[model samples]
Target: MVLLKNYISLRDQAEIVRICHILGVGPGGLQRPGYSTGHKLQLHRTCFGRNWNQETKCQERYNRDGSIPPLVPPELVSLIVTSVQDARSHVNSHDELPLMSPDTALVNFYTATGRLGLHQDRDESPYSIRRGLPVVSFSIGDTSEFLFGHSRDEDKLKNVLLESGDILIFGGRSRLIFHGVRTIFPNSAPPSLLQKLKLKPGRLNLTFRQF
Candidate 1:
């Protein structure tokens, strides 16, 4: 796993947030995802290019409202490409990191009290998992306490602060590492970003994958 601090520029951050806001007001917009057992997650989510149905535990082209999901914007795709390159460059692990062409993106918003339990993103195709297709994550809005470890043992996990504009990527040997968000620090967003985007007191995260 690699974490790039302040990887996204302020202008790009605003643009991405703007795009999310536009898509989120529509029929297939941001809504809380729940499991088949009727347990709702702590975040609001929407998808681009493909919708991940939490109940079915699979990807769907149409959302719960019977609307096609918004396509993954070209600009965001370019950003993911560059982010992967930069991440590989940072760790000098180009050979270990496979090239990624993200066709689906999960855009999630977390309130101040929101928290996700430790879990692995293992729902993608087995071939994708075997090839180590990376999950490129972008963070904006408030800072969050990110917990990640190889095992589910909480006491042995390591914690890091994921601030706005941070990009975290994990692939290859680290692709299926257990991870979760512990908490959000209220009023921790950059003043400039808050003023420009007028986002709520929470965290905005977008994770891209090939699906």
Candidate 2:
């Protein structure tokens, strides 16, 4: 895992929040197949590329009803891809980084009590999964206690504090690690960040993947 602290500036963070607000936020219910009702997170999701199917672990251009929306904005994809390459280059000079392009994004809004269950990001295509393409995640707003483990055993988990403007990249051997948020620190977001974004007390995480 490559953790970049304070990687995004306040100005950029504000812009991202603004865009998300314009796009929309919600209580993204169990819209994907195989997910039981009420098993979904109380967060919003703005998808890009073909929508991801949690059940099939694949991307489809249309939903079961045959509807399609625009893919993630090109500018946003480029911004993240550039940052990932830069970080990868600095961390492993001998290894060549894959040409990463984000085809999907999950923008999650977590209130003070919201937390994600331990899960692996294994929804990408077979080729990308085989290559172990990294998932680039951006954190904004309140801090979170992120937990990760090779297995589901809680005793084996390692914890990390993910603060606002932090970026996390995990792939290769560590790509399939089980990870989730343990807690979100209440009222921990920077005043400027909340005010500029006009968001209530909560944390916002944008995770970009190759799908």
Please give the RMSD to the true structure for each candidate, in Å: 1.3, 3.1
lDDT per residue (tens digit) for residues 1-211 in model 1: 7899999999999999999999999878989888768899999999887778765665566547777887789999999999898888866667678879998888999999889899888888898899999999999999999999999998899999999999999998889999999999999999999998888889999999887
Q: Score every model by TM-score.
A: 0.95, 0.86
Predicted candidate 2 versus true structure: per-residue lDDT over 1-211, tens digit per residue: 7888898889888877877776553322223233645466655454555565555444554344455535677767876887787678656641434557888877677889888889998877887778777888899999999999899999999999999999888877677889999899999998988877777788888888886
User: Which candidate tops TM-score?
Assistant: 1
The stretch of ten residues in a row with the least summed lDDT in candidate 1 is 54-63
**lDDT score of residue 202 within candidate 2:** 85
The C-alpha stretches of model 2 lying farther than 4 A from their native spots are 25-34, 56-66, 93-97
